[model samples]
Target chain A: MQRIQWFKWLSLVLYGIPMLLVLVFPFIVMVSTSFKTLEEVSQIPPTFIPRNPTLENYREVWNIIPLADHFRNSFLLGVGETFLIMVLGVPAAYALARFRFAGRQPYLIFLLVTQMFPAIVVVLGVFRVVVALGLLNNLAVVATTAASFSLAFCIWLLVGYFSAIPPEIEEAAMMDGDSRLGAMIKMTLPLSWPGLVAVGVFAFMDGWNEFLFSLTFISNDEMMPLTVGLFRFISRFQIQWHHLMTGSLLATIVAVALFMTVQDKLTRGMLAISEK
Target chain B: MSVVVCKELVKRFGATVAVDHVNVEIQDGEFMVFVGPSGCGKTTTLRMIGGLETVTSGDIFIDGVRVNNLAPRHRDIAMVFQNYALYPHYKVFDNIAYPLRLRKRPKAEIEERVNTVARMLGVQHLLDRWPRQLSGGERQRVALGRAIVRNPKLYLMDEPLSNLDAKLRVQMRREIIHLQRNLGTTTIYVTHDQVEAMTMGDRIMVMRAGKVQQIGAPEVLYNHPANLFVAQFIGSPAMNAFKGRLETDDGKIVVATEFGRFPVGDPLVARLKPDRSPTLGAREVICGIRPEDITLDDAPVTPASPQAQVDLVEGLGADAYVSLTIGGTTLIARTPADCPPAENQLVTIHLNPNKLHLFDPITEETLLALP
Candidate 1:
């Protein structure tokens, strides 16, 4: 028993060391680079830690660009757009999962086909529409298109979660004097919160980090999200390395914090699906 | 007067008919059971009455009012699902009190009703726990409480005890029956188990292939099965059946079966009115009798008693199932436990009068219904 225990620890360490390095090493580099001076950042031999740690990059990135507006835009677009997708997606998924339609299987395949189009390619077509619709320089346009891009995958994940629940639960609710809609609200929706949260988190993250659409579609600086705002530190000649690194590091921390809050939900949702 | 009336109710899924024009009237406060094999549309019928499944082409009447277009909640019916269907998130109190809460009943009344039901089911202490925390039996009781709290006009149950172990199922069977008797609410229960059908239902409706084969009291079904389906489906261990020829010999009717040549009685002959079925006279007929109705005498006291070879004996507390072969056919006889014949032993068995049933092989219709 002692030998087995010892062997198990050996295996964990063997597997854990490289995985931790691959996962955590880049974040450490980003943080350390964000604090270093320009010369130190571009030094001949790269240092793992900043010898002369400073907060100048943080102060400059805030002042140089409309960084605060970009931050606000990212959140509004991320959370607001994600909320819209959920309101629309969960019901569509429920119908697809629970009810039968003439072209359901083919329609699902078609939704998946929509997911395969590259964001860059789709953004070009969307910009053409934006020009025709006179919606240029609109943050809403960026949020709407990004949400549309993420909608199909969101519905697909939710369909699995909804379909896993027995229809009997809803039927029971109805028999308990609830309307059909009420039954869904009271029974199916609550049971599927974890899956719904996972979808919300994904859409939010996609909206937050979205770059190509926000860069090309919204030419106005005030309307730019963080992903595009991060580019203001780069010019034709030289990149402001520390400001860019500091901006990215801040974004990463926010994403990490949000993910940490909902990682339990994500695990729970996946576990619910996998259970027989 | 009947409290529930389902008239020519039909449910068709695409080209397949799930319920083929069923008609049944349930008395006020009666416990009516629907019994059949799986996919025989018993659950579908109950679901239709509950308004979970839509009425494809028929009208349902509760208290003589047409409820075809009424929703489940509007119909004022409560249903206990086969899997309990208790909410995983809600505590037992909230789960049971949900119906009252939905109607916006006063706070104190909801609590009172929930408590009353909890105490009735002996789950008052567990009322604060979530459904997943309870055992299967506990979950089943909570499901019952949820249904009973509604005090609806009708109750529908879809094999609600099928999930429990055998011992618990028997115990719950009695609990439900007792509860239903006290409540005196009209109920329609669906089950595939003949024992539950016989024990719980005031009347049993035997169904096969989406059509109701028989609807009558349990004793009526056992004594006078409307058809072969009811004869075979209504009793435990099933009725012993054999292919045979019905012939008149020496002014007596006798069934010449591969199992044994047994004497058929006047009551069965009079019931068949055999002279009317000239085609049925020469054709093969099915002879059925309940297992308990067959008397075995290993040491024959009569010269005319038929002999059988016992192949197996399964002893229960009061009786043993003695599987025997007579001539070339096999049949199970319910024998006294103390006198179970040893395997492969020769024994003499006699059929009881007034209990013989005959069915036409081609049609499988009871001869009693022939004329």
Candidate 2:
């Protein structure tokens, strides 16, 4: 048994290190490049670690562009999309989870079918709608678009979470003198808190990292999120690889931190429907 | 207190009928139990009266008010589910006090009522604990406290004690009976255990295949079952049945079976339908008798006693069940544990002639109105 244990761990280290390095290599590159000077970043035989470590890239990256304004735009878009997805998704998911009606199976299939196609496939149609509404370059338009794209995913996840809870809890509440709506708010919502937080975190991350729709919809520099704002560093001339890496690293840390906090609940919520 | 009347209640799930036109009127403060095997519509009937399931076509009246259209909350009833359904997020105090809080009762009243119920159910010490922290029996007590706290018009319990261990089930059974007696509230209970139904109900309703087979006081059911199903279903060591034909042996009526012939007493013959008495000759019938009615004696109790070979003996402290067979026909006879016959020993089995239950071969209905 001891020999078998030693062999198993040896195999894990042999296989796991390369797989892990593949995942974390980009973050390491971003960190190392963000601490390098402009000349050091452009070196042909680039040093994996900085030869002369400095915070010059971080200081220059902020001064060169409206990085603070970009931060605010991304923050607003994430919070906006999360709020909209939860507000619309909670009730829709609850209805799908609890109510029995004709075409329910078909409707669930339709929700899945909505998620099968990529957003790029319908980007033209969405762009047409945005132009017709005369909301070009609007942050609200970008947030709304991102929210619509992820609504199906949010609803599907929340339906699983809500369905995981025993319906008898709500039925017991109803028997105890609460209306159907009242029972839902009191019994079902409290039990589904973990699921709600998981879905909200996912929606926030989706909006925070979103690029395609924001690029297509928003043109103004002040309204641009980090995804498009980071592009200003790249010109028809030389690209500022040091400043670009610094901004990308900053944006990634926010999303990673949020994900780490709710990692436990998120896995459970996702596993709920699959387990069923 | 309220009187609940279900008028021709029926529930259908698509092509299958779950409850087939059940009609029962529960008296005020009566304890009515619906007992049956799985898929027998007992739970469905209870759910319909609780307003959880919609009635396909029927009327449910509570205290003279037709509540078919009313919501469950409006109907003013409390139900204890099989799993107890306690709010895991709430503490024991809040779980019991939820109904009053929903009704917007004053803080002092809610606290007082919750405390009173907790004391009554012996859960006052666990008031601060969550449901997950409590044991199965404690959780069951909390569920009971929640049901009784509101003083609702009626209580509907769906196998509330089924999840507990056997010892806890019996203790809770007695406690529920005592609590119901003191409260004097009408309650409808559903369970598949015949022992629970027999012991707990003021009137037990036995159902099968979405239909009620019999409904009466427990004694009435045990003494005079409406049909073959109840006769066999009610007793623990189920009533033994033997296929036989009624015939005249030397000018005396007797049931002749493959094992042997036994004379049918005059009292039993008088209880049979008078109109069919003339045609009773050579009529095939099922002879049913409870285990307790069949006595195993060392010597023949009567001149015509049939001797049986004891196949197995199961002792239960006070009494023992002896499985006796004669000519391939097996019958269980109850005998004193101290003097049980040894295995494979020959014993004279004397079936109490007066206690015999006769059923028709085709319809399976009782041929004699047992006195």
Cα TM-score per model: 0.94, 0.93
lDDT of 2 at A82: 95
Q: Which parts of model 1 are misplaced by more than 4 Å?
A: A257-276, B258-260, B274-283, B300-305, B369-371
lDDT of 1 by residue, B1-371 (tens): 23999899999998899999899999999999999999999999998888888889988899999988888999889999999998776888999989999999999999999999999999999998878789999999999999998688888999999999999999999999999999999999999999999999999999999999989899998888878888988777889888888766676778887655677776667777445453345447888889999888878766666788989999998999989888787788898898688998889988886788888787787877532
The local distance difference test score of model 1 is: 0.87
Tens-place lDDT digits, model 2, residues A159-274? 99899899999999999999989999988886887788878888888888878998899888888999899988888998889999999998888767767876876676555433
| The candidate that achieves the highest DockQ relative to the unseen native structure | 1
Each candidate: what lDDT?
0.87, 0.89
Q: On a 0 to 1 TM-score scale, where does candidate 1 land against the true structure?
A: 0.94
Candidate 2 stretches greater than 4 Å from native:
A1-12, A51-56, A235-238, A254-276, B249-252, B274-280, B300-304
Tens digits of lDDT, candidate 2, B1-371: 89999888889988899998888999999999999998999999998888999999989999999999899999999999999999988889999999999899999999999999999999999999888889999999999999999889999999999999999999999999999999999999999999999999999999999888988999988978878898999988999998988888887788888877877888988888775562445888888989999887788777666899999999999999999998889999888899999999988877787788888878888888656
lDDT of residue A233 for candidate 1 = 81
Which pairs of residues collide in candidate 2?
A: none
Best by lDDT: 2
